[model samples]
Target: MRPMPRPAEYGQWDELPDVPEVPTSRMGDLAVLDVRERLIRLIDRRRSEDARIAELEQQWRERGGVGESPYEVSRQWVRRQTTEGALMLAGILDRLLRS
Candidate 1:
């Protein structure tokens, strides 16, 4: 079987522009630090959300076999995780943009 082409190999990679270095000015330094900190927090929150979702899925799977039931516990778990993650992302974006 032929290997599928990755999106990056197909010229689909979108790189973010690099942040310019701030001079020794106090205010500029503070602003740069704040932006860097906010970016770190945003990444950490996203990682936390991903980990929580993964844990929930693992727990759901370990619950037992999915028999002939109509309602799926894993599906419900995923729905809740997605909603919560979206809410968290909104808060993160608000903080990042407001700063």
Candidate 2:
């Protein structure tokens, strides 16, 4: 069987540009910082959403009971998913940093 040419050999894709390598320690630090920032943003977003939900719920209460709000139910589902994703990401990052 004949071997197929690699993309680089055929010029199908341009070779990547040379870039200076970052130190492992520096890279790890950067990864940790990035994760922390992302987590913070995620938490802040969730908090804002929770506050909005609370406001809406209070307003609903002010008015006589009128079944459940579809929007609120969907928002709660989204919030739950986001929380789960954040927890998983944090766990993976923790394991990576530990190693």
Clashes of 2: 0
Candidate 2 local Cα displacement, residue 39, angstroms: 1.1
In candidate 1, stretches whose alpha carbon ends up further than 4 angstroms from where it belongs are: 1-28, 65-99
Error of 1 at 98 (Å): 20
lDDT of 2 by residue, 7-53 (tens): 23433221222222334675757676676566667667667776887
Give the least accurate 10-residue stretch of model 1, judged by summed lDDT: 10-19
Q: After superposition, how far is residue 94 of candidate 2 from its true place, in Å?
A: 0.5
| Total backbone collisions for each predicted model | 0, 0
**Clash pairs for candidate 1:** none
TM of each candidate vs. truth = 0.40, 0.59
Off by over 4 Å in 2: 1-28, 66-72
